[model samples]
Target: MESNQEVQISTNAIISFTDSYTQNKQRKEKELLEFESKSARAIISFTDSYAQNKQRKQNEQQESESTLSLAQVTSRLESLSNQIQYNNGCKLVIQIPKLLQSLIALVTFRIGTHLKQEIDLQRIEVRRQSRWCLSSIQVYGDEQIQSELVRQGYGRVMSITLSKAGGIDEEQDEEIYNGLRSISRFLRGLHAGRNNDYQPSFQPLPLLARRSIEQLEEEGANEEIEAQMNNRYNGLIKVWANDAKDMILNCFIYRRRR
Candidate 1:
């Protein structure tokens, strides 16, 4: 009876050990599956975020390229030239130089070739060592004549005076200013490349005018004439002798024929 009771106890102990081992193996397997599932989820979430960021960047780049293309198209369209009729009047466009600070430009639209009306350019300012308020209309003549005068160095630009009243509309003033500025720039370029060898066809002034100019030069009383002589026609005496000076002085003193 004692041997039989010991065998039964040993058998019971072996069964309990087997049951515990099986329970531990199943728990470890479940934990491993849970950990693998979490790792896969994390990897998938990271991939999705990366793809979204890349796609968003590409979209922005495309949008920017489209905007640039549209701007270029608009610019090209605006630059297209339109036909202008001389009968209606010459549409003159003058580009002002950057050196001139105020009265952005002088322009005349629909100006007849023979027009000699005085123009009023409002908000004309000359910026030098000090700011000077200039006359609304600094110059007179049609677009063709004014353009020629400026081209030939016969324009009385330095003698412009400020007006007491009456000014053009703001929009017209701005347009004129722009045109004048453009012309200024063009004239500057032309002056820079002026042919020293090309002599202008000049007729001698009358005896009376020549005598007056000579007296003015001798006395040095006219500051404007002195300034013009010193600055604009430098080396005049050396190049063309006293005759050239007399000729230019005559142009300033006498009325120019159209």
Candidate 2:
């Protein structure tokens, strides 16, 4: 997705200063409104056939596959629970990642698209580890990421208008080279704002720049480069999802006193 290089913009702090300061708290409430990814298909698919066959051998067990959602049940848990609770009542909580990703994908897709034409976002995703965690809405998407940087950049211009509704502007940045300029500028601007200043321990790297780094690591690259690359890679991944988790917890803390 091309960046919205020329979208008119502004840094109006009208997003409720109270809420902005309470970014953590707002983050929590926002979090509660969302749930985690269920399970992954790659994992689920592998377990499905294995699970059914295993169940057949344990004919003494009486668990029905229909009872659980694909995203909520795991092969091991299902087996153990069925075995332990044979002819008895039991509670099983099997979590999967695929379902969660699907949910995040759906929500993100909707949000990004709904807000798209305005800034021209193509897609959205749940944060990096939302599938692993139970509640997080850190949105992710290549196009949306680009869109965010682009929109945030163009939105700052006084000549441009921030009130523009969903309508694609003719101008868009071509690639990461053009896009990061806006993102870097936007982030720097965010640092200027007092509210978003509580910088986290981790820093993020754009997805566009990760593949080569990862590829090099797999090839057993040099220590200095690998360490740096891994640190940056993991940092970005954490910032996307784990940072949100911390933010949500802190939000809860601040909320109690308020």
Candidate 3:
């Protein structure tokens, strides 16, 4: 009987030990799973943070570079402004020859490899820019500078540019009108209040004005194209005609004053 009781006790102890070992193994597995999940989460969070930081740094660097570029541009503009204000545009005076050459090329539209219409548009822009440049020179320059331009044959060159209409294609009607407008502006800039004797011996502004008006009248009366007739380019031509009239009157008044 004692042997049988000892056998039963050994079997119960073995079963309890096995149950306890199984519970411990399950708990260790749960802990290991939780640790692995936390590690994965930590890696994900670190990667996301690193990416955000890298992008932020790149954006900041770009912003900083943009700011530096803007600052440099501002500094240069301020320096140029100071130079222009203090020295009466001495720098501009020194660059007159180069400026004239560039303006001449632009006004003539002789340096492009674009479509015909696009080139014509560019020519219009360049002509307008040239007029503005000349106007600026007239406004900023004194009599001495004006005389220097005259001595440099600026008057002769401008007159010829106007007379030739900058070599614009005649088929480009709009460009023709624009050329006339710009030519009137060029003439005004060249000799608004200047002495007649000081002006280049080119065709007189009054005579040129008459010729331009007559040409416009002829075109309006004689053009057979339906598009040309409906365009009323002659009406628009009056804008340049009026400008020429003003130039003529100014020339007469200036001559009388002299």
Candidate 4:
């Protein structure tokens, strides 16, 4: 009986040792699995951060390049605009009738006086044929002077003809003749004083003989008739000259190549 008991006790002790070993193996495997999961999560997080940083750098580089390109384009446009504005290739043809030489001289004088610059008469080409005159001139001075002339109704650009090479096209002989015809017609109408016909009738002052007692007493009979005539004539001359100046300046001048 003692021998049988000893064998059973040894068998029980072996079974308990096997169970402890199994439990330890299972616990180690669980810990290993958790470690692997944490490593995988860390790797994924690192990769995502790297990708975001690279993308942000690329976007910044593209924005910088775009800004540089826009600046270059703007600078080029301003340079081109300045070049075009001051270009000297442009010319003008002004037509005036032979009968209005004095008017043309007056207009030229006024232009010089107002602009504070002498008229370059050598640059002007005068062609007198039959009954009319043609004055061809080159466009000079800065944009300010050109703009001022336009504002004052001195220059009317009838047409702009471009050259084959993108410069000003030379003026044609036919254009000069056409301009003369137009000017002649305008001058004819103006000289006839058709616009004066539309003016309101002038109200004459009451004669001294027909004046009221109070008026006669206030204004003496010895009032100088010559002085009154002179004043009236001067006023009329001023008004008429201004009207004529505007009419002449407002005429169309053809722009063409030199």
Best by lDDT: 3
TM-score of 1: 0.18
lDDT of 1 by residue, 48-108 (tens): 6556655664554345334324233223212211101111111221221221221112111
Instruction: List TM-score per model, in order.
Output: 0.18, 0.16, 0.36, 0.17
Write one digit per residue (lDDT tens) for candidate 2, span 42-154: 45564665565445533311222123322222222233223222321111111222322232222222222343242233221111111211111111122233233233222
Q: Can you tell me which runs of candidate 1 are displaced by over 4 Å?
A: 1-143, 147-154, 160-222, 227-244, 248-258
Error of 4 at 138 (Å): 99
- Which parts of model 2 are misplaced by more than 4 Å? 1-233
Measured by TM-score, the strongest candidate is 3
Candidate with more favorable, higher TM-score: 1 or 4: 1
Candidate with better TM-score, 3 vs 4:
3
Q: In order, what lDDT does every prediction score? A: 0.30, 0.25, 0.43, 0.28
For candidate 4, write residues 53-129 as lDDT tens digits: 55654554345334324233223323322322333211211111121222122222211111111222211111111
RMSD of each: 39.4, 23.0, 35.1, 43.1
Clash count of each predicted structure: 14, 17, 0, 1
Off by over 4 Å in 3: 1-97, 111-120, 123-128, 152-236, 245-253
User: Using lDDT as the measure, what is the rank order of every candidate, best first?
Assistant: 3, 1, 4, 2
